[model samples]
Structure formats: structure tokens, C-alpha cells
Target: MLLVKKKGQGVKYGYQFLRMRYIIMADILFEDIFGVKDIDFGGKKFLRVSRIFCESESFKMELLLDVNTQIYPMELGDKFRLKICTTLREDGKPDTGEFNQHDAGPSRADQFEYVMYGQVYRIEGDESSATDTASTLSAYVSFGGLLMRLKGDANNLHGFKVDSNVYLLMKKLAF
Candidate 1:
């Protein structure tokens, strides 16, 4: 969700309308983590990883994986694909501390955090094609074009696009 901050507004009434952009892709990768050695907030500990390559954009991201779970096989040359729904922080700030305090508790300080809800689609081997790699991976699939066709709106304002392919993928993941 994209949050627009109102000018001349006090902290009580600081933020205005939220514009949400939703992209339905198969999977996302936790490229790198850097800055802020350890993150402990919202009852979860996050290890900040830097130099994340999200599709075409390289961003500094934090992966909130299980603290006990070690990031395996994510080496310098390892390649994998993931499906994820990514969004900018809601307070128009990269740092979570910039937002107003919530009754829930302390907010995270990371600019953005992704909730990994999907599974690993493919693991790249030495023979994998770098150019058409995303398309070749089942997890990196995109539902944008299919969403436009099914809804006939040509714009994906809602969260997801439903189609036969989506159903098929969902079914496959279910089992």
C-alpha cells in the first residue's frame, strides 16, 4: 500500500489516503541483507540483507525468515525464483520509525518487509538460461495479462487476477 503524507498536518492527522499497487508474481528471492545487524520488532527478528535483486530492480531488503532457520544454498552464484507481493511502506518513509506509534506495538525499522507466502518454484543449475530464466521458472509466473483479460478492466487495482492458470497453480501448490 502506497501512503501519501499530508502537509501541514500534525502527527495526529498526518497520513492521508492509501494507494495500493498489487503485483501477482510466482515467487521472489531474498537477494541480500545488509545494514542494521539485527532487527527485533513486532514479535519477530529480522536479519537485514542488502543488495536484493527483485526482478529488474535492485533494492536493499530485510528477510524475516525464521530466526532459527539458516539461509541455505543462497551463495554468491546460486539462483532461485519466488512469488511475492511487494509494496512500499505505508508511511512514505523508508525507515519504520518514521511512522506514528500504533497501539499494536513498536513498528519495524526496515524500509520494507516482505511476507513470504509462497514456495520455492525452481532452483537454477549451471545449465540454466540466464535470459529467459524467469519465464522458465514456474514460481516466477506473472498474472498481470491474465488478470486484464478476466476482469476486462485492463487495470489490476484489486489484489489478484483469477483465471484457469491461477487456479491451476493454486491447486498444484495446495497438494
Candidate 2:
């Protein structure tokens, strides 16, 4: 299912109109963590390690989380629930389909906010990439069912792999 909401729309209509294109529900464990220090990107502060690579040994698969959130709390050996929600686009409208105004409801804050609960499955430094003091090269992680991908700097995720469980909050700012 996919949710396409225009600016200033909400759930007054119903859930049938607001569906998630992708939602990953699973339990995860943190295996490793890495960080690169202060730098500027697009006028914003960022760290070295910016991506979370996850794998499921039993499933024989891996997923990557590119997060943009700053200052996260997660750590090795920690466990938690993971929820991932993705819409077709930041706006409620489809690129090729006709949009129905009736299907759109009031524009509420909840419509723009995304929240997920999960644990740190695993975190490992990326060995393929060289680590520099200015930044991290790469890292790896794993969980049972869910994962999230964001984009930001490594410092933004500093001290993230320290907590047992974490709540991931995101908001779509595009129109």
C-alpha cells in the first residue's frame, strides 16, 4: 500500500485512503557501532558513519538503513522492535495517477510524522572501507523483521549504539 498526501491533508477521510507503501515489522539486535567526527554538509553538522547495514543470518539477507536523524541512542547486544513506514512520495499524490480530493482529509501533524520502535540488532565497522579520523568508512547491523534507512552525518548517530531500545521518529518535509 502507498500513502500520497498533499500539503494540508489529514485522516478525516479514513485509513483506506492513507496506506503505507512499505512497512517493515521486525525485532533487531545491535552488533556494532562507529562514528566520524564533526563536519559540515549543506550547512548542517554530520558525522562519519552515516549508514546502518543490517543482515539476517537465518534469512540470509541484508538491509541498509540510511538515517538523517542526529543524536541517536542504540548499542551492541540491545534488542527492540523495528517499524518502518514509507510512502510512495512525500506528497499524497501519485506521479501518474489522478488524485481524488475526497480521499484526502485534513492535514494533520500525524500525517507528516513517522514513528518506529525497535532494538539494536547488531553494529559492526565496515572493513571494506578505510576509516579516517575525520569520518567513519562503514558499519554493519542486523535485526529480525524491520529496518529503517536514513541520510545524515556520523556524529548525528553518536552515542546511538549505547541504548537497549530506541524510538525512531521521522517527518516528511517535502511537499
Best by lDDT: 2
Write the residue-wise lDDT of candidate 2 on 1-175 in tens digits.
4445566874344455434321211111222222222222224224523344433333222335544345443333222233232212244332233346676544222442435445555444444334554333222222223444322234423434522355443342221
- Model 2 TM-score, 2 decimals: 0.30
Q: Please write out the lDDT profile of model 1 over residues 1-175, one tens digit for every residue.
A: 3344457763432123222122112211122222222323343333432222222123322222222124221222222322233322333233332335463343221322222222232222223445543222122222321111111111221333222122111100111
| Predicted structure 1: lDDT | 0.25
lDDT of 2 at 57: 32
Best by the TM-score measure: 2
Deviation from truth (RMSD, Å), model 1: 18.0
Candidate-wise lDDT, in order: 0.25, 0.35
Give the TM-score comparing model 1 with the true structure, all chains together. Answer: 0.17
Estimate candidate 2's alpha-carbon lDDT, on a 0 to 1 scale: 0.35
